[model samples]
Target: MKAVYIAKHGGPEVLTYGDRPNPEVAPGEIMLRVRASALNRLDLNLRDGKNYRGALPRVMGCDIAGEVVTISPNAHTDLKVGDRVILDNRTKCGVCESCRMGLDQNCTNGKRLGVDLDGGHAEYVTAPAANAHKFPQTMSFTEAAALPIVAHTAWHCLITQAQIRPWDDVLIQAAGSGVGSMGIQIAKMMGCRVITTAGSDWKLLKAKELGAYEGINYRTTPDLSKRVLELTGGKGVDVVFDCVGADVWEHNLKSLKPGGRLVITGVTSGTKASMDLSLLQGRPLHLMGSGGRSRRTFADMMKMVRQGSLHGVVDRVFPLDSVAEAHKVLESREYFGKLVVES
Candidate 1:
């Protein structure tokens, strides 16, 4: 098999593409003829030495969409050979308390693909049967590859964490991002009134095309909080999606209405945030940091994908060997949606 991997963490240049041994299929696992695998911030984090250790060489990619060629005899009844599918990169120990409660991502003894575990940056990968979902007949492999992580994160933040409701006004920062663009769509799906921030007029127009009630160009209007207040007639938004932490932390906090909630799923800008102690009492706010979703949550997200209720807006496609270039593109923050790496 040919795969891209990192022997040592440093930068995207550490990603190596070359011949590799065939993946071993275990009981309840299937080997895929990988058609496509998408990149996530997690891939770049692991490659740049922020997340994983170099104890084991790593093939880094998370969302995988492919056709199954070989299946272990012990595999369960839900799937079989020749099935087109998308595999969730999240794994959980079934016996753990969180797993028993259906919170698989929070399992005490679990692993993530492309981080602590080997992932899908190859021509073949072994995926657990439980983590694979049959691809919809109408969806292409490239589209399927873009969904598992971005769509799941958007669903977790809007539907599960913030509990968004129809008619509620919401503000999403970095509206041009893969997750942010997806988040805008998901919020619109729930009938929420949404305002989002992008850096340019072109990006703001793109966000508007995706159903944002209003688009604010952070580059043009530096006084975003004041603008938000004006847009809402002095009533701030019901929720604020603040992935641009530290730099935009206080600004986002000021955009929310009294008793409003803020859902944070990432900190691509910076991790640290300086919160004013009095803001808690002055506005009566709630801050929530959400990570991966539960098994049921991801399944529900897949259901929407199959039903055409949610669609991942992919920006570009890259080959497995061009993993380094993909990282540089994403790091530049220029793409409107996701960039996938096809195997």
Candidate 2:
């Protein structure tokens, strides 16, 4: 099987495409003839020598949609050969405290596909039955491939952690990002009023097209929080999704009403964020940390995709052998949604 791997961690140039042994299916696992995969910032991080610190020849892809070509004889009701499925990025040790509570991402012994093991960048890959879900036949593999990561992230932060409700205004910082695009759609599906900030005019327009009720251009807006307050008629937002952590934290915090929720998943915009402790105490804000979605969330989200209420916006496509290019695009932040890799 031919797949892409990080020959060394430095740049996209480190990505190598070549043949490797076909993965052997283990009991309680299924071999998928992967048709398409999507690139996330995590993939780029690994390529650029960030969080992923592993041995050489690391397979770097997490989001995948594929057909089950073979199934091990575990006889689990959740899986069978010939069923179309999407890979779940998170896996857990069922014995862990978090896993026992169905919070797999928070599991003490959690593992991520692609980072800790081989992922779906090749013609075929094997994954635990519990980590892959049968997808709707009506959708394309490219679209299904886009669901696992961002959709799960959105579900985790907004649905599971924030407990968002209808008519609530939510602020999504960096609405042009791959996760931001997913967040916008997710918030809208939940019946929340979505507001987002983008770095470019094109990105802002793209966010509006994806159901954001209001789009603010961050590049030009000097007083983002003030504008957000005005947009909500001085009420502020109920929740603020801060993916661009340091750059948007203070601004987003100022935009939130007293007792408002602030959910953060990533610090994509550097590591430091300055906050006013006085305002935090006076407002009694609910600052929360959210990341790593569960299997249940991924499964329920796929149901929404199958029903046509949620859509995966694909920004670009590259052949499985061209993963280096995929990493480049993600790092450039030129994409409005996902960068797909076809197997």
For each candidate, the alpha-carbon lDDT, in order, equals: 0.86, 0.85
**Cα shift from native, residue 78, model 1 (Å):** 1.7
Candidate 1 lands at a TM-score of 0.96
TM-score of each: 0.96, 0.96
What is the Cα-based lDDT of residue 312 in candidate 1? 68
List, residue by residue over 195-251, the lDDT tens digit for candidate 1. 999898888898998999999999889999999999999999999986677788888
Model 1, CA-based lDDT: 0.86
Q: Score residue 58 of candidate 2 by CA lDDT.
A: 74
Task: Estimate candidate 2's RMSD in Å.
Answer: 1.4
